[model samples]
Target chain A: MTIDPAAPPPRPPGRPRSREADEAILAAALDLLIERGGGATSIEQIARRAGVTRATVYRRFPNLTGLLVRAIEWEYRNTTPEALSWPDVPAMVRDWARHLSEPRSRRLVRRLYGTVDDLPELLRAYDAAYGSHRGRAVRNTLEHASAAGELPLHCDPETLQLVLSGAALQHLAAYPDTTAAQDVEAYFLAVLRQVGFPSPPPAHSTPPRRSTSR
Target chain B: MTIDPAAPPPRPPGRPRSREADEAILAAALDLLIERGGGATSIEQIARRAGVTRATVYRRFPNLTGLLVRAIEWEYRNTTPEALSWPDVPAMVRDWARHLSEPRSRRLVRRLYGTVDDLPELLRAYDAAYGSHRGRAVRNTLEHASAAGELPLHCDPETLQLVLSGAALQHLAAYPDTTAAQDVEAYFLAVLRQVGFPSPPPAHSTPPRRSTSR
Candidate 1:
């Protein structure tokens, strides 16, 4: 049966029970994860929240870890796939700003990072699924920037990626209340500039020369 | 009662039970927090691990949240008090390198970041307890660097701090197995130089002048 990804499944009369149940389960798991944090979330709680029987949930997901992984996959499935095709660094930066502005996104990321110790597999699964792809996209953009002379001579793309990721995490941590997308974008741009990434595409400028080694 | 911070109390014979219990409870809580992650930890589990009655645990810590907060406090109490008096950026950097080299420390930090959504109060208590003082120390160091002309003309210490904190978190995430202190120090120094922090105390260098506005 064909399923529309965006449209909510039609009311009980027409919707496929299996697909509807899957969405409910995934959404419920995500909600519980964000609301209570991951530690307190349980299969029983998820089942209850989703309005589905434990047997039904178990039929689909073997365990809580599997369910959590699927739920995260569902949550990010929409965004990460297209991230690789993003046209330029600025567009990616804008998207990052918009996503980081959402309180839910920030909370979700925090919860994910929290899983590193207890459920290393969950994060590992996530990284394998989407993080690597997203990383490649960013690296491609950075290499393009380096080729275009937008980055400083000493800047390594790999190190820049680390610094940029760190800046994003730190910005989220330090300014959780700053929910404005523009504010987030401004902060990101500042970090980029501080790391010597020329923004707004400096026009008619000479290629960057390596600063003299001290 | 004056309790010695370093030595474990004399075993059972003339030792005070309350202090011993407190130590056991705190230690157990920290262990569980690091080992299993925070969500799965419970008072019953902590009490069991600590070999104390739930009532005994409850008598000291009124609730799980309070207990968790206290556990975190106890975890950091020994180190934070001395952090403010660190002599210079290099000393602090070396200490940071040493701390990040420990797998336990990396896991603890990831777990702490994870708490931002579910148990923000836990992190907030931690921040209030130690993070602010640490921030002041870093800020003071950055200001001293600026005064000494060790930073670039366009550098903002606040932004640099954000970038540095982000970089640390990213480094921990990206290279969880790089447990050598020297390697971590090198990564940190590279980051510092990338951000224009002029490491190895540049010999008699002229003060930085602002790069032309883009």
Candidate 2:
């Protein structure tokens, strides 16, 4: 008997689309990306590892770039830290640095840079997502510090944003493989101190209270 | 008569490997690089602009990458400041920023970044050239500043090198089109001030005293 091309494939009665299939595909894509880098990963390999037919993969993503973008978005959504309620300026900046310096995040960033030259649209989307999410948190922290009189009075939020984000991004670019989380933290603290943030008081010492005898 | 397959061509009677031809080709290459970025220029164009035969260009430099590297070296040699003496640390840093912020240098750097992914050998050559010239100058400046009490005592020269070079490189990358030389100067000044360099004395209306009044 001839199969009908227009007909939908038969499924088990009352079965919903499997979320597990989506996860498996994305996980397979990430593995391929990390193993082979952006240039070498192919749709065929991804489909094979996902244990899905090529039709299923293509139905989800029209092209490799689409699949890659979706895979990145999934990874980012899963990896991003939960909303932080920072207690102080120093703590907030440190947390921001920590989030950026994580190994998975660094790998994602490198992959983004690798593809940026060929896929300008993808780069724009990545930047928009990054700016909307991480950028907002950084700006909020800077504004809070300014209001608390912790940051220099002359500091412009935009300039500070450029300095912090640009420096962090440049550090990643310059040292693609070897930079560590603590290195990022130290650099952040140095930048803060350079920009006139007062160092936090030493935890080990309590100053003597002035005598009220006079 | 058929030319011998393995024999080298004899030099023309009147032209003894003209030095002028080499200089003209190099000058044309530099001009093209500055005006048209890297990807658009070719050896044929360089030869035509220099009023030399394509064979002459090939004879001087076997490949395009070699030609570009030599052009960079020539540019650096010709443009680098001859006066080694720096009156102050801040002035030195500001001058370095100003040089890198120039349009020609910025274009050269962008071109270098473009080729880095495809031509790892060329990248290594560029790095070596840069390190030998600019890196040495930077190290010397930091050492001089430290000895003169201009730089802070605690700053490691190597760490300072990475930070300063990374910052300067990123500044070029960020503002590739603008003639914002003053922005770079201001940035270097801000970095200097942050690192504890003494700010220039404020302007005074009255004439200075010859002797101390204390």
Candidate 3:
């Protein structure tokens, strides 16, 4: 027997906003960012490229900075760690280094970093978001290592998290053009080895217990 | 008998550039930076504060970025490292941390880092200059430690250099508002302890050996 047809949807609105238009605008922003850098990307240009009016773009995003930020977030979401599986600590670190050192990622960082002079608020927001998200992951990794005895019992997990995240960010800042993936991996391994991780032969030494006197 | 008198020298064609004016401008720029963030400091305001015409300021520096950069370099030159005798590796680390974590140093770094987005060329020049100067000091310390058998013999000095510098910058960036000088000292001490520095009690159960593999 044939199934009964569902009732038709109600048409209460004049014209529904198009999801395709939103995606198009985001894509156009990403393209512009890749081609001209972040400072040069404009909402008007994005609207024109997406075949939408400037008002439509503004209606979606309150300001240029907001639009740019969302566009970057969208691109980052699409091209980040979500799609990939990280099997082990070393493998995960390698993946992270590779992703961060890519040309597109470097350009995005350079563009955002350059905006700190004129847009301090945006810079603060970027740092806050980046730290909150990435910092948590690094902290979790260190904590797990500590719990598993992969890290020293005396290891300060918070400090380790800070060092890992900070070291990674500073490495990117200093060597924007060069991909020191192997060096980064080796550096972390050295740190891990220092922190009582067993590699080849077991770690030769233990970290000292805290001293009572300063 | 009386000696013959020397002849008077000829007057210069034009008044030599005023050292006082240069010093005044630099001092004013620094003051303005401390009061207002780097982005808010202007060449016109700096010139007015220095009691020099805009043309004179331009004659000294091509633009505001150049002026600010020169002022920063001047500040760096004036702040020479204090003559302190460190009794041990931990003591040295503590001294270094205290110096960098001071309010004056933090303010300078915040201003420079905050402005890096707007002035890429200036920022590049600043980093290159800062790195070269700081790198030399770090190299000396590392070399001394290696010579004294303080560091792992197989450790790549350049890699260690990168790691230490990256770590220091990251620490500063992470705790921009924190004045926990002791915490900085403790953090480095932990790292040093992990790396097998010769603490008084020698906490490690066994001695660390240089790794054979790269």
Candidate 4:
């Protein structure tokens, strides 16, 4: 552990390297939330888990609510695929199956729903930051499917969106354990079929192309 | 309001008339839970609201968990219709619409979901006492519909049950405010149509008879 005189001194609090600390703090908050639910989580616990001082955490996030909201937003950004990347409904379904199959995802979702009464701001922040964007993307996909004649003639896009979202919630509640990604995807496909989605996902006349941005 | 010595000594604490006090306490517990959410509710408040002593409540139920569980069960018994009473799925949908339109019902359901982590026992008790029974009934209804050609040929009864239950949850999360019963019913019917339920409801050959038990 020789100190190199030519090297810059260890970075102090609020230094240019603070971005690294910021990410660490947010990641730690999300981890603690998933492992120990909302009621048991605390700033002290998060700081300890992140290997930072309490002052470091407080300097970055003045309050627990702000920190939690930021942490959840980070998780959404890191885990969810970009809304515009999916080529079709089946692609979206496949991505959702992968997300839902993970036990960590299910636990985090449960905490979100379970905290609505206590910390409604968290859900509101999520809705504003990610939910609305994802919802619009889904609606667009459904509309395209309807136009392509892949959906039932009378199917309403709004109702279908609600049904699909509800089905996800229902799955979390009904099955708390981890499941195989393929099985979950298969189940959602069956639900789609029941809801008038054509089997084989309607070979697009234009053959939808994957987004090149990703 | 004169006390008569001939009035059977005012009915001691352990008398058979305790059922009256039992109902009062349970009703009060539910009222407090709905009005103030789960985290803020307590036995003392329930006792005061019910016009009974705290000891009376404790005598009937030893713990908060037991009291809340029984209170929720009592609510289900009083509000939900018998499983066998519905002549068809449409009838059940109508009843659900009415239930969903009530602000009190929605708030109570929110509490149930919000307390899942803090009070896992409460949700588990509910699942055992009422959820399983209601789930079976819904499954039976869907199965009947499938046999009668009301549902799509590819529709799976289990999947449909999950989707319908999920839709109810999604409705609650999306719209926290009370809606017109007719609007809710219409929305649900549209969902059913999307899931392959024939519109205008099926005309029964036997003219499905409503149960006369009531």
On DockQ, who's better, 1 or 2? 1
Per-residue error for B52 in candidate 3, Å, reads 4.0
lDDT of 1 by residue, B86-119 (tens): 6666777787788779987677667667766666
What lDDT score is found at residue A25 in candidate 4? 95
Question: Which stretches of candidate 3 lie above 4 Å from their native place?
Answer: A1-54, A78-85, A110-133, A152-156, A180-187, A190-214, B1-17, B28-42, B48-51, B79-88, B110-131, B152-157, B193-214
| lDDT string, candidate 2, A87-205, tens digits | 66777777877766776766666555544444444445566556457777777777887788877665656666666665676565555445566777777776656555666777878
lDDT of 4 by residue, B64-96 (tens): 778988988887774344643466789878877
DockQ for all models? 0.46, 0.12, 0.16, 0.46
On TM-score, the stronger of 1 and 3 is 1
Model 1's interface RMSD: 1.7
Runs off by more than 4 Å, candidate 2:
A1-25, A28-57, A79-85, A152-157, A174-180, A206-214, B1-95, B98-123, B142-162, B172-179, B186-214
Residue-wise C-alpha lDDT for candidate 4, range A1-214, written one tens digit per residue: 9889999888786665788899999999999877765556899999999999999999989788889999988877753445445778898788777878998878887777767767787778777766677778778888887788767876878889888888888777766556788888887887787786865735568768889997
Candidate 1 segments whose C-alpha is farther than 4 A from its true place: A1-15, A79-88, A199-214, B1-15, B80-88, B199-214
- Model 1 chain B scores worst on lDDT over the 10 consecutive residues at B79-88
What is the per-residue lDDT of model 3 for residues A1-34, given as tens digits with 9 covering 90 to 100? 7555785666556444566677788888777755
Candidate 1 Cα RMSD after full superposition onto the native fold (Å): 11.5
Task: Tell me the whole-model lDDT of each prediction, alpha carbons only.
Answer: 0.79, 0.67, 0.64, 0.79
Lowest summed-lDDT stretch of 10 residues in model 4 chain A? A78-87
Instruction: Provide the lDDT at B122 for model 2.
Output: 43
Query: Per-candidate TM vs. native?
Result: 0.81, 0.62, 0.70, 0.78
